[model samples]
Target: MAHVDPSAPLEGKASKETERKLKRESRTQIVSFVFMVFITTTAFLTVASDVIPSGFAIPFILLLASVQVIMQLYYFMHMNAKGTGWVNALIWGGLFVAAMTVAALMLLIGITKY
Candidate 1:
């Protein structure tokens, strides 16, 4: 058995847990970045193809983008893992109001006839 020295710093078990959390965080960020890149590239291709013209597709794309952004913010941003209920509730409330406002305008304005 090796002798322990009080003067020297010793390795603590917390280091392993800290490292694991860091790795998980790094992985989450990388995955989020990859997903963002994929979404952006797909958006770019859709815009370039013009098969789904911006006039017809922009709103749909915007909705998907909002979802993806929320996913990243909630996950990789650690909002879901660390935030209080009030914080999350506030975010959801904002999203709901934004959606409701957009829906009201679109419906009231008769923007989508098709």
Candidate 2:
């Protein structure tokens, strides 16, 4: 038996299907990254511009932030990939619980304020 180097780089051309998949994935990542950058720029502009009132800018920035978070999770984190059903469910469940907790706390605080 011959010893082999485990850390050696892989050799040979990948299959057509694999190459195509890789190209598609790279394209998607590029697009998502561009989109995220655009979103960030828009958020910064919204906050920096004096024409937009603080009332509107705050919510607009928040909306952009939410979109960025979702994109990061789905694309950068590969949450949208196959065989991630359980992971997706658990993450969504956690989000739901967090949202509900925030809502309940807001309501409690509001009631106590009165």
The prediction achieving the highest lDDT against the true structure is 2
lDDT of 1 by residue, 14-107 (tens): 6888899989888988888888888878777777884786786788678668868887868766678754688788878998999899989999
lDDT score of residue 108 within candidate 2: 100
Per-prediction count of colliding residue pairs? 0, 0
Tens digits of per-residue lDDT, candidate 2, 49-70, equal 8899999899989999999999
Candidate 1 backbone collisions, by pair: none
lDDT of 2 at 30: 100
Please estimate how well model 2 matches the true structure, expressed as its whole-model Cα lDDT.
0.95
Query: Worst ten-residue run, lDDT, model 1?
Result: 75-84
Per-candidate local distance difference test: 0.79, 0.95
